[model samples]
Target: MNESALLAILLSLASAVGYALAAVGQSRLAAQGGGGMGQLLTRPLWWWAVGLNAAGALMHVAALHYGPLTLVQPLGALTLVAALPLSAYYARRRVTRREWRGAAWTLAGLTGLIAVTGPASPGDALSLSEALAIAAATALLLAFLVRAGAHSSRGTGLGHATASGIASGVASALTQTVTASLSHALPGGPLPWWGTSLVAVLVATFAVGGLLLSQAAYRGGLAAPLAVVNIANPAAAAVIGVALLGESFHGGPLGWLTAAASAAVAARGVIMLTGATPADLPTPLPTVLPTELPAPEPAVRITA
Candidate 1:
């Protein structure tokens, strides 16, 4: 492989490791139980996890700069595969047989999807109408997901996790757009008047939203919700890349069908993974004293 491809792979894998570690750390904190963001923020470990996540993002951007979206974004799915063993070891959680199968399915399906997406070609600068349309549609979808999560009997963790992934994916696509826009702009030139700064702000908003949702996803466990986010985030990003960024598939219509089928397979895997829960695993609890130590004898038998 060329140096650039090798670098991209290394960076992508490192990014995956960083994200996997962050997920495991945050999941542990969430498992400890807390009332609100304030309570969770008090822990230093939470900050460390945030730092790891940020670092991972930086690595991802670097990878993107050096590689194509089809290559870098798809590799991001490695996070889910990496999360498996990390959760098992660091979280002291069991990896059920079903969970293992789910991970395999996710890996297989994601790989196929990425392979089908093929290489992407950079396109025209994002227009205001396009940006607004995409943002509106995403917002509406997120709103619906939020409401569904609130009322769903199957648990809102998946819904929230999926929302988080979508947000992250959108943010990723916007980041690339902004980066491209900046590069195309002449040095010392004024920023474009067509809401460039507005787009940047929106990017930050989506990123923060995704971060919060990811932490919430851990409230359930590291396996299922993580898998969902893993699939959703990149899938959404890929969509933006194709629709807005002018990326294209290799085989045209046939490729689209293949990609769709692969996505379905990956979605099914996420559902299967959700079946495994922390509750299913053995946990060590503190041994209880058989009986309360008899109240210490009265200090000096003064009652007598």
Candidate 2:
């Protein structure tokens, strides 16, 4: 790899660590819960989480400035690995043997995935029409996931978290796209208005939407919902990287099979990790209901 790619990989890894810390902070806030977004403004921990996320985003943007989206997106998955020990330390959660195994599996698979993929090259900026189409598609999918999350009982939390992840993934792609456009803009010249406007709208929508949904994801529990988010986020970003950004993998049919197997192994690891819970973290009460009431004592039957 070239120096630029190497730098991007390092920066992306750093960003993953930041994101992991931010997730842990947010999960803690969720566990202790008592506020909406407005209310969270009064809390220091919320600010800490926000700051970490912002820092991470900045680093990610910088990484994308120098690296291919495909490379950077997959590297972000390292956040899960970073989060394990951090969660134990900051969240006061114990890392179980199962979680360690999950982490190992994820790490091994990601290593293989990276090895099989070819080095990344710089990408082209999307045309306005292309950007809009991508934004629309992402929005539609996000809508579907939100609807499913609202009604589904089996994996409601996972659905919302996955939606959040998808939104975040789109936001990341947009961020990289915007950055590329801006970089190519004439230095000391006025910015291009039309392209800028579309990017601004799309980026803001997905970023804010992702943040809100992520907060909600924490209500279910840290491990399960977080696993879903971590898994979905990169997968979505990789799709955009491959489809819109002109990135690709090589090594023919054998390589494709290897990549698929690697992804499956990583996904399986996330599942295992989700099953391993941190001891003593209380699940949040349902938002749809008021505080739980005493089970109404069996109403004495009135004489017929």
Best by lDDT: 1
Error of 1 at 107 (Å): 1.2
Clashing pairs in 2: none
CA RMSD of all predictions: 5.5, 7.1
Q: How high is the CA lDDT of each candidate model?
A: 0.79, 0.76
| lDDT (10s digit) by residue, model 1, range 32-147 | 88579888778888898999999999999899778876788778888887888888887566677888888888877888787876544444445555666777888899878878
Model 2 misplacement above 4 A: 1-13, 62-75, 91-93, 111-123, 151-154, 185-192, 278-304
Instruction: Tell me how far the alpha carbon of residue 289 in candidate 2 is from the true structure, in angstroms, after superposition.
Output: 22
Candidate 1 residue runs with Cα over 4 Å from true position: 68-70, 118-120, 123-125, 152-154, 185-194, 242-247, 283-304
